[model samples]
Target: MAFCTSTDINCEPCLYNSISVPGKGWCLSCEEGLCQSCVDSHKRRLATKNHKIIEKCHHVASIRHLMSQTCKNHNTILDRYCPFHDDPVCSLCILEKHTNCKGILSLDNVAKNVASSSSLFSLQQNIANLVKNLSQLNKVRTRSSKQLQSDKIVKYTSVRAMRKRLDKHLDTLEEKLLQELSSKAGTCETEINNSLSEIESKTKAAYAVQSNITLLKTMATDVQLFLAIRDIDTSVTTETNWLREFANQHNTDELNLDLNTKPMEDLLRTKSLGSVRIDRIPNHVPINHLNMKEAQIPREAMCNGIDQIQLYQKIHIQYHNEKLVEILFGCIISSNGDIILADGPSKKFTVFNEGGNHIKDIHLPGTPSDLTEISQGRIAVTYGNSKKMEIAEIKDYHYKTVISVRTVASCWGISCDNGQMAVKLLTERINLYDTNGLRIQQIKVEESCPHYINDITIAHRHIYYSYPYQNSVFCLGLDGTLIWKYESDFLQHPRGITTDGYGNVYVVGRHSKNLIVISKDGQNGRELLKCNITPWSVHFDKHYNKLLVRDSEGATVYKVAFRL
Candidate 1:
């Protein structure tokens, strides 16, 4: 270029001057043009360290107004100090109330601390982003609200149209029925009025010939005969024709209309239109099926010191010094595996777990012959000597009797099935009662022996009772029908009996000290176990794998484990 004037400030030589570099401002205090790097070094000097150093705006004219402006509240001229507080506040005036505040600090100092903290910048950025997101969310909410309002209007319109159609159909049906009834009533009324007018005319003519004596007598006689004939004809012809016509028109199967007969009002009032409604049959499709395989019993015995038996396996055994005591009554186990001794000479019932832990002792008013778990966590106990049965719910190892009944004979055994309790009285009769303690029925043993009923076990809609003297077990249905009687040949003195879920009957004989397993259908019988002691009060647990047996002489309970 034609040799730029070196004297011009805007000349290439001036622009290339090292001191006139970019990103710089005129330093008025230093009276020199300084770049940002040069000013930074000058600010770090010990004397200028506390001085204010702001970024230089590339356009000085744009920020020039801010440099001289004063804070309006302080009414002070712009200065290089905070006009609101202590230090050289410049021409700006600080309010008296704010002058004493201790929070005053230089703006540059505050900015420097904030800039040095990365967390402060991150927080500021996050706040700004959140504000932007909130604006966008507000627009989305407005759009969704508009759409919802439009959808509601559409649905309301459709509902209104459907309602109108339904109302129209109902109105048409109502109008048609009303018209038919009105027409029928009008026709009947017109016919009745015409018949009444004809009868009135005949009566008026008969009254006209009552003046001349002899002529009136003949007229009267002839009129009477004519009236009688007319009456008979009216009864047989007119009334009958009117009834037949009315019946045919109305489709009435029966019609009877007579003035002396009962009024139509009475008939209408007495008539009742009944309807038979058939219940809707439900679909028998099952939503889910449970494939429960029959539990298999292990061949080897699994005894936990206590005998472990599977379903129908004798779970409890009691030995009294190696002699099997006569266990003729029932037995029950608590939720904690404690056994309640029943019918033993303990005269008092004792509770013990399978681990031989004695839990409680229940003193009896009389000899408690039988025990069974009823509802509400209670057991039904029958006192043989007292001839009374009581149901008690157990809570906190205490008894709360809900019902009590005195037996006609010594209560020997008690059993519950299908919410009904059956008590075998010593009189060889089983009395049945509802769960409410109301006697429903009674079953009397009619066998030739008529032995005393010692124990009763209910299972699968049948009651099995033992006849101790007869050495037989009788099976009876819910209605007391004798289903079958099993007479034991080898077993003598069958004391107690229980049933398994598979309908297998188990009988324990004290004399033989054996458990007899009989098929449900009375097809086969086998000796399940032959212990030395009498197996009394046999019961199956929820698992049906183990049996609980109580020995009267042993005064102990045994858990016998047997396989299915």
Candidate 2:
């Protein structure tokens, strides 16, 4: 080990390099020269108390490079390299984020000859390219701003011209319509109040019974089951009868929104002067890509024609408790590397540890389609052709549904962000709903693949959807406007889609029998891997870069070592 710049000749500096006078000791674990004061302070902190330390020697063999950098998240030394992300991380980060990432490199090997590597030269060239592109974009944005001001004036002039041309009889029509609107609003309020009261009472009773019955089952005792059996039977029977009655009597969806001059309603509203719908102006603004850096793998590997996950481990989860069944559609990995898979044939969610050892399995009410993590031990799962989405909480290897909401039709892929959910309906539209199951917006695709959406993923303002039947993928804005559409020869039956932190999209192609990576702009694509088994569902942990893929053929889930 080489001496650090912090090491002094007269008196060993403190653990922190800034101290002028020192003379206490050295932390062998931290590999830094420490003073008596720092040594005392170090032991006082809970995280560093047990670290190895020794008296300072003439030649302090402390870490010179490692101490210079730290993990941004944990605020500790960056000592580990996450090969999946191609970034240095701390030990704390390894468990918090990279537990599912299989192959991790040490920082020591990554730093050796890094200065001479072409990566540094490429980075310099990128910076130069970014500067040039950004300068041009700034000019374009300035021009657009000026054009916007001019357009505003022109639009205002047109509005005034049209208003002057309108007839004076409009006031009588407006007054009559306002009265009818107010009357309708009053009636709607009363209907909403009645529904709310009934819903609240029934929801409370059903939840109470569900909790009691689930608790009874968990207790696994004859006495508890016997005690709750009568109440459980009564509650279940009452709720079943109430559901049938409510379905017949409910006036929930009778009213329809319209944009016609009169009461004439058209589901597809187009070519109207006043259209109330969600849309976006085409994004023609040029963005500087080089400065907006994405996660970078060893471009050398990519350039050298190494286009695969490199090392992948598969866990064939066919049989559970001596019964074999095929998995449904999805897979998710917890922060601790616990694999939870939804099996359609068994109607169960099976779990396994990082080492592929069987854990506990949770039963589902129906066939599961897709699942997304809600919290550390909770997830939201969708049931295919059932039109039901259930939120489940996992505790001690047991799972129970806490909430369930019905979508408009058969729900397929489900992803949630900002407490709002984007659910793909069987009718080839994505419905945005609030936490309380209120539909906020419906995303209808008119450009392409207007048939069926296999999977959808959300990241901030961007929504990604895969068109399996059409062999295409589309990136859209939150307002449901297409940002860009990608159709590739490499993509055949794109079943699952996910995005990395770099805005790059990854899609699994069932027909192509490969995992494909599409650039952030949807302009370029390359095969990530040629699969042994056809892949259906795919998910990427952006924080960890670990890829979880489900094979459509069987109960096998492949944990691929995904790199940037």
Candidate 3:
């Protein structure tokens, strides 16, 4: 019945010849239906031999009608799938829009066994829960309706029995009380009926989706199932969120009528028999929500690039003495998510937990310029002008120095990865050191450096550093080969620098008062965060997907979301 009025037309004719024979199979790439004779010839042809075909009996024509097989922009058959964009495209679309997209796979491969995937399983569970919730809510309404009816009759009986003991004046009061009871009961009934109508409508929709899922599992092709599931999941999520809000606002609680017969007990006090009033008893029906992890599944891995960031927590650094000035410099997030900041002017290392609560402060013999995590629960700090780097184990309020490495020039920026350390000097060179404090190699930046390098980070075999005076960031290989240099007007006076391990660099700009993220190749960059004050340092914890930034007043943490 798709795009056709007659049965002969319903089954698209074989594309190989002019004959109007009913098609027995559908070719995905060709986007055409074929007869049995053409199906055999299609598989035998050299160009179409490996083409994926679905049986016409599987109702694939309906799939094509529901989800267009052709790209609307290019007006051509969609044969390729781009995981980067999460879109199906034609050859023309690839040439026009997806030329640089990575991981572009054939549609057939992406749809392979999609019916048996976790996405389908989650969809099934979500719809089933929706039906259950609607049924339970309906049950509550039915119980409340029966209780209301029973309570109304009892109140009516009490009013009439009380009127029997009084005079003719009481008869008028009885009539008035009965009318009030009926009116109140009618209103309750109307509300219940309206609620039932809503419940029934939602239930019918849930059942329709459940039935379609069953059909998909049995009669639909894998590609058809894949496309249908995405749309179905979106609909289910909308319905689920609406139902949750509705349940919170409108619960069918039990209502009862109370006959206030105080006047009836004291005949001399008043002429009225009684007054009818309503009493409410709280009732609740639960809705079990499905786990939404499947709905949030990403198309690509997170190591590709950062999509955005959200403020997670804020920490206020405390200064014990008002006279001691706090000049925050180095920042790092331990493996367990503890934030450590070095205050050079104060000559102390302040620590905080993931919840932004202060843990402790460790005083140092010399002023620390920067710090880096050497291993789990262990950290190394660089002292500016002291020409020394101290390795220590820190946890909460406990701290102990293990060893100190002496540098030739004043030590400034420091980073450690896999037992190797890269320490930047106040001069024009970076000294590499091992765990035993022995110098392994040195890199000279006299030609490219601009006065001084403020901070450095090493990740994935590349050294990343920032130059605030020049408003630039640089990446270098192990052999001191300059890979790429990134400069942007938005990143003026860059200070702290780090990487996401995927090659994207994160740096803080002091004068610009913002954070900038540069792409792996350094050809593209964007401002990520606009700070209220000058930010002095930044550190990224890849294991926990957390970012730490040290500013003039205090530090802050962010939960990062990444996409390729």
Write model 3 residue lDDT over 207-233, tens digit each, in one string.
877866776677556766777777777
TM-score of 3: 0.48
Off by over 4 Å in 1: 1-329, 343-346, 448-453, 555-564
lDDT of 2 by residue, 320-434 (tens): 3223222237777775678777777678878887566788878878888888876677778889788889888888877788888887778888876767778777775788876
Q: lDDT of each prediction vs. the true structure? A: 0.50, 0.59, 0.74
- The model with the greater TM-score, 1 or 3, is 3
What's model 3's lDDT at 167?
80
Which regions of candidate 3 fall more than 4 Å away from where they truly are?
Answer: 1-9, 12-68, 72-75, 79-106, 265-275, 278-282, 291-564
Clashes in predicted model 3:
0
- Local accuracy of candidate 1 as per-residue lDDT tens digits, 311-378: 22223334343222433455766555666665346656666676656677766655667887765477
**TM-score for each prediction?**
0.43, 0.49, 0.48
Q: Which residue pairs clash in candidate 3? A: none
Worst 10 residues of 1 by lDDT: 1-10
Error of 2 at 547 (Å): 0.8
